[model samples]
Target: MKVRALAGVALLTTMTLTGSPATAGAPTTAAPAHPTAPQQATGLRAVADRAGLRIGTAVDMNALADDAPYRAAVAREFSTVTAENVMKWESTEPQRGVHDWAAADRLIDFARANRQKVRGHTLVWHNQNPAWVNERDLTPAQLRAVLRQHIIDEVTHFKGRVWHWDVVNEVFNDDGTWRDTIWLRNLGQGYVADAFRWAHQADPQAKLFLNDYNNEGVSAKSDAYYALVKQLKAAGVPVHGYGVQGHLAVQYGVPGDTLTNLRRFERLGLQTAFTEVDVRMPLPADPIKVQAQAQGFTALLQACLLADRCVSYTLWGFTDRYSWVPGVFDGEGSATPLDENLTPKPAYAALRDTLAIAAR
Candidate 1:
């Protein structure tokens, strides 16, 4: 655990109690420029001590095959991890007849070896699914069987290792109504309840959450999610929390409204999380704009700290080098609190300061 405490490697040799420092052998050796060992980053524990925040990173398993910079960055930058894409249904189970866990297995392995917490991405969503899962081709009865089997097999596969599962993702539309996805269209409302129940049956200990992209702020979308959760809980479903994906833009609704919705979710006896937090900003960011972005992170963290049920806060990506914003948004932007070079931006410091302040 103490091997990679810094960028360079250091060796420890035990000595007899009566031995003096003069008895030690050569302590100097050529070391790697970047820290690839865990013991090296323990040296960064000083920085973390002063920062007082649960810094984390999102790991893309495919990147682990290459992407040295990313690998070194995550190994050195954060102690906690979230699977960047491995846990997605399309990645974990690309074919109906097969469940490929090679990618997800890497994430689970990394988490276990590091003793780190993992936030399992999604079980059900409108996107990131194979075309075969589309209900347009299947009869109602057939679709129900497919959905049931998918949930059961996938959940059972990663039962104890995955601490949290986004059991149902993007279940609601932006207007606060249920989506018209294959699951909803085929199985009706019972499908949503059944997903959570099936996940519980497969892994009774996994914390389940409903995740969405935009509902960061209190609006029609958020209120709709709230009402749906209330209905689910009333029916005694296994729904545990709401994941308000924090992908705030400078132009959208008031950012504080996200916190308002979070607090409201907590009131309903459910946990809350800033599931996919990323404050996007136009490139060549202005000082004021960057501060606003940082403030957004602080606001989200503040909501979590204040809400009794709120537990985890995760950045969409630790660095701007690999965010999904560029693919989804037309214009180029940086969505992460950390700079592309992996340096802590003002937003990062603000996040640290926010947590420190919260701790007090």
Candidate 2:
């Protein structure tokens, strides 16, 4: 899951409840000063529990296997997990019929062992696609068949294990037009509906979602999703959710009217989630920028809490050490609630405070 800002467009993009006090080790500068004994919630999972939402993070097989602390942190903090890439098209079916399930199976096994729900990262996406999919110029009918089969096989494989599936991801451009990916180029916009249908057929119990970034706010991208979701519901498409990837940057400022946008989707009888949230700042993160990042993080959680149908809040990854921001966005890192050393940052405290207040 390399989270990049939507290209060729600029777009702008939480909760409170109380529980036990947050743990110590949070940066004093980032943490709020307490008058009495500093009472803080235990962890994100605890905070989310107070607000009736699930807290999750993306995980990779390597991290689970190699990093003891990472695995412990994930198990301790999150109640749900999304595979960063194991379930993506490129990783699942690089050779078309020759499907691979090793990595995905490991993730599922780990989640089961840890008592965490699993969210299948994606069933369809333009990026990280296998070359074989495009290199062989198949007819519209052939490509459609291929797409349908892929969804059916993948969803069926994970069937009862997955709680949600990102049935289609990043399909719309920032300006509300469909991205001319292989799916759109060959199967047209019809592929979106078809993808959701196929996934639902394979596993009716699993929630199906259309996930994307740049739609966190009330913008053209979100408007496009709103119209698409309405049309899908009218046509009896089994679309279950809309995933607003909360990938923010302090420099760009938090998105406006996010709660309103999420509520509109909920009105369509669809569940909503902060699918992939991370607030990145430029390198050598100073107090001012870090504080701003904390504010941005708290705002997202607050918006989710305000939305009735927003069921889950998932960070892209929990710790900065494994964040995809630095690799993708030069000079930008520290995008998660935990720092590289797995220490809670100000954003973590802010989240705890927000959830605590919301619970009250």
Candidate 3:
């Protein structure tokens, strides 16, 4: 959360086809006119139009904040933007004493002006905390209060704007054990409950999502989330969706059991979204490896498209230029399907092609 583009970076920054349209050229001043009726085939938008799907691109808030050209670049690739990093507690309230809403504000503003729907980054995550929220040695009760107030201030701060907020993030680890987050330590399990309640009070319309990475396949983490969601639903928490952050690796391959995991959650009547979707190839962009990675993207897209309640599918960030992979992954972070300067990579074209075929 709070993914910032290093200022002065050339700026920001796509793939896969389950039915995504092709963004073939540079995003232009004029959007093309739409056909009155649905086509058998076309690009990402077309696929969505015919099938009623949501295709989105994640973007950096700072890119939209002070940089016009960068903003234009992003506005070109995506019609829907998930504030890539902004909106988290750390970025918004880095110095605890001060509340810096300007960044998140601009992102929300950009999405609104563009007629783009936004997925609010997060509300309760152990990472990206304001220094002051936990700086002092507060007791469990005091910490609980901090958590509640944080949910209120943050949720109310952008009420009615964002369509969905990742209310709680990565609470379960790969092993199905609860992550040792400060929220867990101080506020106990009830914090998750209270976050949803406070968020509901702040903006009843905004859908609340429990977001996590690497839950694409049925694993311990997915099981843990599944159990927690059942409990939350039984307890009347306002959780409406699941954010399957698609940070998958090409080596492992998308598991066969993911469909089962997805179906189980949908049975609970919750919408699912492929939140931070990106499948990374192992290394030096070999053509073969790239092809496998492209296939991986196709697999992920297919999963989302087929899942009954999967509402949307979004690539984490569009191009290699702006991806967090290089910053986070050591070997070579060429997981993205778009190249620098935002050209349509093979992955992008392949997805568009898939969408076209589906429409037909």
Each candidate structure's count of clashing pairs: 10, 25, 12
lDDT of 2 by residue, 205-317 (tens): 99999998878777888899999999999999999999988888887787668888898999999999988888888888999988988888877777787777888888888
Over the stretch 322-357, how does candidate 3's per-residue lDDT look in tens digits?
777765656756767777665667777766655444
Q: What would the per-residue lDDT of candidate 1 be over residues 111-175, giving only the tens digit for each residue?
A: 66665567777787777776677756889899778777888888888888887788887777666
Q: Give the TM-score of candidate 1.
A: 0.82
Report the poorest 10 consecutive residues by lDDT, candidate 1: 15-24
Best by TM-score: 2
- Sort by TM-score, best first: what order? 2, 3, 1
Candidate 2 CA-lDDT value: 0.78
TM-score of 2: 0.87
Better of 1 and 3 by TM-score: 3
Question: What's the TM-score of each model vs. the native?
Answer: 0.82, 0.87, 0.84
lDDT of each: 0.66, 0.78, 0.69
lDDT (0-100) at residue 157 of candidate 3?
A: 85
The alpha-carbon RMSD values of the candidates against the true structure, listed in the order shown, are 13.7, 10.0, 9.5
